[model samples]
Target: MTVKDLRIELTSRVVMAQILPFGLLILILFGLAISPDLVVVGDARRPVIEEIAPGLFWLTVLLSALMALGRAFALEADDGNLDALRMAGLDPAGVFLGKALAVTVQLVAVETVLGFGAFVVFGAPVARPGLLAATVLLATVGITLAGTLYAALAAGLRVRDTLVPLLVLPVLAPVLLGATQASRDALFADPGVPGWSWAGLLAVFSLLYLGVGMLAFGPLLEES
Candidate 1:
């Protein structure tokens, strides 16, 4: 089931269209908006690009995740395949896992590109390689799971485009906060606390959403 979902999502042009170019656009926009300024001290000059790359990277992920999830289910709804799946006796939990897995894969790809953009465009260095990698993993999982769940909730709505963002962004606040802070700590030296702690919080968020989706998806699909 997961493999089928992966194949469908990987082959979708929409995924490629949104993942790289859109993310690069966001990175460039952020760079233009937040250009580093020169500050002089004791005849020495430095370019100060504040610790904002992390937040901007996460923001790109949030926006892209919304688009990916919307298009994924939109296709299912448009083709009437969602109902067909429900009647086809596949476990709703499996379906949810498949969708979540696909979204996670797309998001990870976007995040990788965004991470590189942050490095080259924003000058955010990898201060803690291991911690940074873990933060990326946990944060992506949390965002993807939460996005997938709300996407299902708004799957049948007429104005789902607007409704899904409303439902998703608010719930994603904790994820954005944790991911941004963790990324910042990982991209800079001596952040005062271990980034792994924030990764743990993100892990909790992912588990909570995963459990909810597994329990609610079956009933949600039936009612939708």
Candidate 2:
């Protein structure tokens, strides 16, 4: 199931061509808004944008993920594929995992592009590669899990285009907060902040949503 969904995502022109460019454009717009001008600090100087780059990067990612979620389920809903999958007796949990994993892979690719854009456009440097990687992994998992669940819930709705974001974004506040803090610490090596602790929060968030999606997806699939 995972492989099938991933193949669809890889070959889909909308996912490959449109979604990625949208994410990059958001990053570029953020760079323009923040201005990469260095400001004086206690003993040195840092780009004003660097201070906020982590948040900006993650914001871009979240917006992009919303679009991806819409596209993923829209394809299924529009093509009557959801009903077909239900009739085929595929395990709902398996289907949920497959879709979530595929979305995660897509978001990872988007994040990679946005990461490079952040470095070049925001002048942010990575000071702790390990922490940054952990943050991205855990946050991405959490985002995809919760997003997949809500996307399914909203799949049958006429307002799903507007509803998914309204349903999913509020629930993802912790993820956005944790990812930003952890990424900032990773990029700046903030001595006062415990980036690992924020990463742990993200891990917990991912696990909690994973269980929820696994249990609830079956029912949601039936209703949708």
Candidate 3:
């Protein structure tokens, strides 16, 4: 089922169509706005990229992921494919997992490009490369899982485009905070401050949503 979902998204290439250009646009806009210009004080100069990089990276990801997630169930609804799946008797949990897996894959790809773009454009060093990678992986899973869940909740609604973000972003406050702080820690923390705790929070959120989605998706899909 996961493979089927992945194939559909990849073959259609619509998910990538939404993620790549929008993600790149964010990176370019932020890069231009921030500019990494030097600030002068007492005959010393410093770039502000470090100050903005963490928030900028996460913000770009949030916006781009939002755009992608809003369309998660839309493909099914728009094409009358949801009925096809229901008729096929596919397990609703499997359907949810499949959709989430496809979204997660798309998000991870977007993040990979955005990560490099942040480092290069913002001049933010990967202070802890391994920790940064782990944070991204865990945070992405949490985000995609929760986003897919909420997107489904808003499915078949005329206002879902607006409602999806409204529903998902508030619930993702912890994810935004955890991922941003963890990314900040990974990119700029003092040598002694531990980053594992934030990554753990992301993991817990991902697992919690995974459980909820597995249990709730069947009922939710039935209703839709």
Q: Which model scores highest in lDDT? A: 2
For model 3, how big is the CA root-mean-square deviation?
3.1
Q: Taking the tens digit of each residue's C-alpha lDDT, what string does model 3 give over 1-224?
A: 97766675775476677678788788878766655352112212243555567777888898888877776677788877888888999898998899888877878888888887766666576679888889999988888899988898888879999999899989999998889889888987776787879999999999999999989999888863
Error of 2 at 55 (Å): 0.4
Order of candidate numbers by lDDT, starting with the best: 2, 3, 1
Give the per-residue lDDT digits (tens) of candidate 1, residues 44-151: 212244456678888888988888888777877887788788778888888888888887888788888777766767655577888889999998999888888889
Counted clashes in each candidate structure: 0, 0, 0
Q: Give the TM-score of candidate 2.
A: 0.92
Q: Candidate 2 lDDT (Cα, whole model)?
A: 0.85
Model 1 segments more than 4 A misplaced: 36-48
- Tell me, by TM-score, which candidate is best: 2
Winner by lDDT between candidate 3 and candidate 2: 2
> Of the pair 1 and 2, which is ahead by TM-score?
2
- Between candidates 1 and 2, which one is better according to lDDT? 2
What's the CA error at residue 203 for candidate 2, in Å? 0.3
What lDDT does model 1 reach? 0.79
Better of 2 and 3 by TM-score: 2
Q: Per-residue lDDT tens digits of candidate 2, residues 92-140? A: 9999998898888888988888898777666676889999999999999
Q: Write down the TM-score of every candidate.
A: 0.90, 0.92, 0.90
Candidate 1 total steric clashes: 0
